[model samples]
Target: MADLNTQHMIDEIRDNIQTGDTLKTKLVLAHLPDVDMKTQNRLIYELSRGDVRFTVPILLYLMTEHVSIVDELPVIKETLLSNLLAYPELLIEFLSDTSIKDKTHLINVAGELRFEEAVPALLYLVANSQDEPEIKLIIETLGLIGDPQAINTLTDYLYAANRDLIITAIQALGQVGTQSAMHRLAERMGTDNEMDYMILSIFADVQDPVSLEKLNDTLASHYAHMRIYAKQELVRIGAKAVPALIDNLLQDDPDFVIHTLNVLGDIGDESAIMPIRKLLGKDPKSANVRFAAYEALALLPLRKGAYTLTAGLTDPEDHVCVAAAKAIDQNYSEILTAGIKNLLRPKGDEARHIAKIIVSAQVDKIFLSLAAEDFFQELSLVYLPHAHKDTKEHYTRLLVKHGFDEFANKIQGGEDVKNLVKVVAVDDSRMILNIYKATLHELGFEPVLFEFPASAIEWLQNEKPAMVLTDLNMPEITGVMMAAEIRKKYSPKELPIIMVTTQNETNDNEAAYAAGVNKVIQKPFNAKSLKAAMDEFM
Candidate 1:
């Protein structure tokens, strides 16, 4: 396929390369663009098979000697690159060569080869270079090499003045995936949320022992989004995180145990079932702890000890009782059914309270088992009208499932909320929203309840509600976070936000206050406390 001029040019270039003729090499390469593309490719094809131990240096020299020439004969650069990859040791040697000023491609090839031997050369470029893009590429190449020797240099960049550099170093260290590398990453958790979340993601993907330990430790963090991210990652980790979570149950900290229980419950591993039950046997008095434990048990199949769930009907807190009831509903047995029936049979205050729990829990089988009871019917009708819309639909489905269409229709016809004072309440829990539905209605205001805070936030942008009630520790956005967004439009006097927190730590109160919360009320709030907290702001 070689034409006369192209073959002559290739022969001249080969002759120049063999004779070590520098000026002639440059002269021959300069004529590359003057010829047709076929001629240029032919020259490259011939040079690719040439003796590159001497020939490559001449090409490198030409590359150094040129702006006009390299742009004119770009194929010379391509030919050099092809040979560099073809001979990898030569690629590493070229990477180490201080004479080759444009070693960007060389560094990239070393990384593609994952040549650990090239780290010192790459580090030398990192130390000498200040250009962000070139240094970033070099750092990334170091990460692809994943050599431990680069860890210290990468660690230094974690606190770089440039955020992009910081992000790059984090990714690089994550790719390193050594124990010390993970420890360095774990040390950066409190830097800021964006960085912390990125680092946590690395830990999650790395899944080494140190990374797992760091993730486990983050469960106890106070920041809602951070803790939520950790809980999600741990549950995603599932069985691998079980041993650590199970060990967490023995710890003295209630908040720590509660968070661990929440993750384990979502993980739904059977091995955790007995350990959790044993944990419950210690008579953990924190209602939040009991609620988390039972919530977790509801997700796991507790085949042997399911009847024990009915005992939670006697829990001092309504939420925990609901948790226990749901757990019993999921692992339903005749013995558990009889246990629940006996617990609600007396029809006294105790029976009324337990029936409310069962209704709120919304277990189809348990609700159906007691559907014919007059006491259950009376309480169900009373609460059904004001229950959250979804809860109402859920029970309506249950009622129709068992030939109680008339009763279902009755609750479905509950009072209209369109005309009442529109007070918006944002919480992720349907159970809590149901409580808001009844409590806010009783307090003489129509409750616009959202099981999703984002939906509530979107609704608030157009219409101004009388007030907004939010809860901390939601999945994507916390109550404090939502309050901050609302405060951007309406001030404390213009629009009031009442932050409902399960934990009453002073620092959390400060965060809510700083986020423009009008009042901070500790949960489990009732109509009385909620109205009192709202009274001051109103």
Candidate 2:
């Protein structure tokens, strides 16, 4: 078959493609010897701005060849990238090939594409090379890639003897460094050397446990510079470090308790659930703790633990009761509805009122995780409110004991919608979709809504949402195929697409990624996890 390609086939394919004959053109492409570089480049250029048919054979050919199409890369850069973002793997092939004449050109292309996978090869080049102009290009490219993998390598090179190299790596780290990378940079705070300015620059961004621990241990140091850096790192960690930051809620410092409660609420850890609930009940008047508890519940995944907060739907604190009402709506609206028939002749007006408020607010729709589905199933089964206050307390304590506090807190707070920072949710499940929609609205985002790929694409062209959230199984277009269509027709650099589903098989993930889904978030996602995935863009 390799030798069977008639020159007539190539000619006919080109002619058919020029005239918009999709079927005949694809047939011709299937028969062509894609390894012939000159012929391949000619075919690619002619159809570079055309549909995505040319992509498959070209990418396949590049993968198998393991060498860069040096002469054609410029044409690709000038023509293809301006119109369509090429596949990262194809760009990686170009960047990694030592024979490519314009290494800088490859780096530039990678930066424009935000090709995270190319970071390893680019870092290797930067670490091993002595070329100043090329090293600068490599550093800039690494910054653009922004993969966590590049952070460690770039940080190590920050101490290199070459001043320019040190500066480049430091700048690159600043651009892409995570909590851990910042911690490393902060560790070298006051060494007072040529690299001190770079380290000081990095200190402004570093915030994590390791850095905090380092700062705490060195608080007694006489240097005013060290003290300033320590105080800044503490603030940067923010209200999310409460439980870890405070020794104990009951006997902790007032400022510590205040900050810790705020942090627990901000961080949305389930481990803080019982403690927060205890505070809510004891000092039911403490706005700081009650608000923190409510936030904690709202941030958590709705589950059995949320029953405590749901019982508190009549809590004196307005926000606490409000949060409980929302949780009832977000987590148990269906169950609460089903349970009404089984309840004694008189249904409680408070529960009814809270449920009404929840139903009124829009719900978010998204794929659910296995654990989250189980939580909903349980809620569906036995949703009756126990008569005893101790019963609620006991269940809340048990929930905390069983590691269900996170879900409990989330159910209490209502469905969280923090991923609204940069996302558009799409799915077929009425309930899941409602939950996601509600969460996004709660997070203060006006996400573009779509029930299918056809609708999604229409919205995408007009709105250009920063990221797309989609489910795998659907009636119209499957998530994978939709992803391929989006990548094929729209510019990936303009909008990153994330696919969500219940499937966890490695092959499924690989296929989704190959189809051009930038990130895969499995179903039953908590708001915190979803928010973390969204935060990658920042």
| Model 2: worst 10 consecutive residues (lDDT sum) | 362-371
lDDT score, candidate 2: 0.55
Whole-model lDDT per candidate: 0.81, 0.55
Maximum-TM-score candidate: 1
TM-score of each: 0.88, 0.31
Model 2 has a clash total of: 26
In model 1, how large is the Cα lDDT of residue 286? 82
The residue pairs in collision within model 1 are none
Q: Which lDDT tens digits does candidate 2 get at residues 1-538?
A: 5665556665676677667776566555554344465665665566564544444333333323423553444554455454335455766666666655456656777788887778877887877777878888887788777787887777776676777877777677767757766665665455554455455535444544554455443333334234334344444555544444444467433323443444454455566666766765675445434544554556556556554554545554433444454444455544444343233113355444333323322212111211244434234213213112222344345456656666444333223333445467887544455546544554455556677778877766666666788876554466777888788666566677777765454655786888888888765554566677766753
lDDT of 1 by residue, 231-348 (tens): 8899899899999889999988887898899889888899999998898888797877887788889889888988888888888787777778878888988898788778776777
